[model samples]
Target: MGCPLVSIIVPVYNAERFLNETLNSIKSQTYNNLEVLVINDSSSDNSVEIIEKFVKSDFRFRYFYNTTNQGVSHSTNVGLSQCKGEYITFHDHDDVMLPSKISSCVEILENNTELDGVITIAEYISEDGSPLGTKTALPDYITNNPFFVRAFERSYIPTWAMFMRRDIINKLEFDDNIKIGNQDADFFLRLLYRRPQLYYLSNPQNRFRQVSKSLSKKSTSTCEIYKKHNDVDIAKLYTQAGYSKVVIDYALAKANLWRENIESALNYIISAHERISEFDEEEKDNVYFIYATCLYLNQLFEPCLEILQKIEGKSFRAETLNNQGVCWAIFGDLTKARDYFESALSILPEYIDPKNNLFALNASESMPVRHFTKFPLRSVYKTI
Candidate 1:
């Protein structure tokens, strides 16, 4: 069979620093039947000049500039409306596509006619292009569950990791109003409602640059798209579409927690606990951590400690210890708190939570003590 054409939609903002490397990586992809739709969102930097250079030298690279600074969702939709490839994917202007990424995904789609799309794993990179590590592993149930179930758990499928048939473009568009930095997650969740079949490929790796000030981390509210769908409750819509109840609750809890809606977060997490038995050990630990966090925020220290103590796996053990230390400190047992903080540091020397807690403990000798509180969300720790 002849090679199928692939279209890559790249949304550019002020990405001049990494734009050249990003485009070069695409140009060097092993798969050659490709069209690059570089949508420039009126970048203030010299990103437009760099894009023009690639367009001039390569037949496959095409550039389109927005008249004004529309956000990523609008730019992505523009590329979606114009792209003519048999297969399509999205890329960020600052991230790199590994050499075999396109070819690997296309090969699987060609061979497995049942899969509507494929998602590959990614490695995290520093701004200087230093490799940090692989992104967190997906839950083990990803392969067998509906794509939305996995998407609900953590929104694992970013635009950069996803490759799909052009048909998906006709069914969905990026929500132009989703400004909370989870536009990709909103798009994927809506797509999952359509029940598209997808596969996760572990072999091909993409480089996802972890910007410290990325919008997702800095944005406090959940995406607007999740608030309503035709005025129907989003959770109700997903439930009608047959998504797992536990995952849906857990996801809502996380969203509410991000907005600091501690009461709502606690409510959703309690709902999740009704079917907590369905979760695997690690997944259960995730729910427990969120539950404990909500309790901690509500100042239910003893209940939070009880839940934190049930989490046994090493993945969250250190954070649990750090949180327990915070509870002890709040209860005015400085010695016990110090011991817990010290134990947490022993387990994870580089962990910032315990280190900060220990410092606070030491500083409290004469000055008024100010204790730090830790809330573990998946792999990230939020200290307050």
Candidate 2:
């Protein structure tokens, strides 16, 4: 089989530390016939030096530097415009693509010409390259039809793991206005209207280092999530762009997610009890606690107690007991509340929640003396 022409874009900022490893990994890829483009987004560090070294040593590597430090989106767009290959993918300065990453993605694009792009799960790693074990599973595609839009949301997919046709790249430009992040997500979401099928690697296909200064840490919440807080507008974007069903599905899913957040943060029992079935069974402690606490707050005592009883471990290991105390205290039953609070304290002695509940249950306005100094209160006369 003839090898496909692939363009790999690497946007450099201050990537002096990990850039070499990333380049080496790419060069070592089993697949050849590759054009590697490095866009030096005006680095004041050794990134340009490293790029120069790579370009000087290899004919396949080409690089350009920006006069000023435009954000990543701008740099990516520049590289996108310059890519002459049939298939394209971009990598951040610090992240590493597996040796098989490009070849594997390219093959998928070739075989599935209908795909706008291919994506895969990224194995999250620390600076030291130890796996953090965070992964998004992609079971739906292999078992079900993947050439549709909604199938993409099974997990978080990023640009590094994706290879798109140059035609798709030509039609879309990275939105540079988002200084911190998420322009790619928005652009990709817009494309889902066409029901572009996306293929992901069977496993995490790259190593994504969790650096302190990555776009995630620097970006606004909206940018980090790559979703607008107001979905109606985003839905409108998808609707106008062509994928009306995706908009609807996103709206429904978003509503459920928000409901989860609210359920997780609930402080009232009665209100919470009404939403019990909404809680996913595998939610973390915070999620369950929020739901149960809300149920207690709403005065749905029996159901609240029942759910509270089911909770086993969490930051709120004491939540069931503490909130039970609330139910008792509100019903003119201070004794029962105190007992429940004490039970909570027994389960987690260091936690302040149960302790605070105890103080409130006892009608003691004075909170614990958080700091204490102890000297011999009385002078020791002699060894006794």
Best by TM-score: 1
The deviation in Å at residue 91 for candidate 1 is 1.2
- TM-score of predicted structure 2: 0.64
Measured with C-alpha atoms, the lDDT of residue 285 in candidate 1 is 84
* Candidate 1 wrongly placed segments (more than 4 Å): 136-142, 178-180, 211-220, 223-261, 271-280, 362-384
Tell me the tens digit of each residue's lDDT in model 2 across 270-370.
Answer: 33334445434433233344444445444456665666667665544555667666666666676787787788678768756667666664556343311
Q: Write the per-residue lDDT of candidate 1 for residues 32-146, one digit (tens) a residue.
A: 9999999998889999999999999999998988989878888998899889899999998888889998888888889878778887778889988899888655532224334
Clashing pairs in 1: none
Alpha carbon lDDT of each predicted model: 0.77, 0.62
Lowest-sum lDDT 10-residue window in model 2: 372-381
